[model samples]
Target: MLRTIAMGVLVGSAILLTLIVFRKKLGWAWLSLFGTHLILAALGIYIVNFSGLLTEIYIPLNPATIGAVTVLGLPGVIMLLGLKITLF
Candidate 1:
């Protein structure tokens, strides 16, 4: 139940953020926002990787990973971490 709630929150946030990005910006502005988002997501991944030393949970910096983090922000990276822990 808790995990379900968290997942729902993540999805809602992603949708809200995505809508804001599309609604308030256009053309190159949104592109810059996307680039910024990608950078932040990459940083989040690195932080996770760094923490992984103790937790044994690391997310690889690949296109799929990047895309998920880029699109979904922190929640997406978190979901990846959860997926890793649950599956691997």
Candidate 2:
């Protein structure tokens, strides 16, 4: 139930943001935002690895991971961590 709610909220927010971006004719701004989010996500993963919290697990840097984090922001990172915990 909680996961479903979270996903619903995430999806709604993404749609809202997309609409706002499109309405303002700021398509390029979305690209910049995505780039920023990707960098933040990469930094977040790096920090997590460096901190040694999940010593035996590592999140790889790749397109799928980047895209998820870019689109969903911090919640996406939390989701990734949750998956890591559950899967491994």
Candidate 3:
């Protein structure tokens, strides 16, 4: 409960800060980038799943993984694969 509330507050603060920092100049650009990242990440995951190359490993669809991929792009997917291979 408390942890959830704190996380919510933290996320809210980050959004507020981004809005303030970007204002109207780059807000749309940022949103578009985020959308592109999301689409690319989803597509990458889908392709990997469809190919069945890594049948032994599975990457869970979740916000953290999505966010990591969003921020890191293809490299992010490679990193996740590496982690999956080494960790599990």
Candidate 4:
């Protein structure tokens, strides 16, 4: 059952990727939206790090944290900060 579900998800993702790549308008829209989101995510982290100088608390700029922020945007940064507060 798990394998079947994974395969279905994989196939669906592949289909979506193909559609995005082939559709010109969709491709542009996808690029612009995600590009903006990635920029916002990086900026959010940068702001936090900059302010950290005063607070002495900040999220480390590692690949894992960066990737999480890049993929999930502002919410990802918030979630990471929350995790740091609760766990560390």
Among the numbered candidates, top lDDT falls to 1
**What is the per-residue lDDT of model 4 for residues 1-88, given as tens digits with 9 covering 90 to 100?**
9999999999999999888789755556777887887778778888987875537558888778888998887889888888887898
With candidate 1 superimposed using the best TM-score fit, by how many Å does residue 75's alpha carbon deviate from the native?
0.6
Compose the digit string of candidate 2's lDDT tens values, residues 1-88: 9999999999999999989888889769767877788899888777766788778878887888877887788888788888988998
- In model 3, the clashing pairs are none
Q: Could you estimate the TM-score for every candidate?
A: 0.65, 0.61, 0.71, 0.59
Report, for every candidate in turn, its global Cα lDDT versus the true structure: 0.88, 0.83, 0.85, 0.82
Comparing candidate 2 with candidate 4, which one achieves the higher TM-score? 2
In model 2, state the lDDT of residue 41.
84
Q: What total of clashing residue pairs does each candidate reach?
A: 0, 0, 0, 0
**TM-score winner among the candidates?**
3
Cα misplacement distance, residue 2 of candidate 1 (Å)? 48
Q: List RMSD in Å for every model shown.
A: 10.4, 8.8, 3.7, 4.3
* Candidate 1 minimal-lDDT segment of 10 residues: 21-30
Question: What is the TM-score (0 to 1) of candidate 4?
Answer: 0.59
Report the lDDT of model 4 for residue 86.
Answer: 84
- For candidate 2, the per-residue lDDT at 75 reads 86
Candidate 2 clashing pairs, residues 3+ apart or interchain: none
Global local distance difference test of model 2: 0.83
State how far residue 79 of model 2 sits from its true place (Å). Answer: 0.9
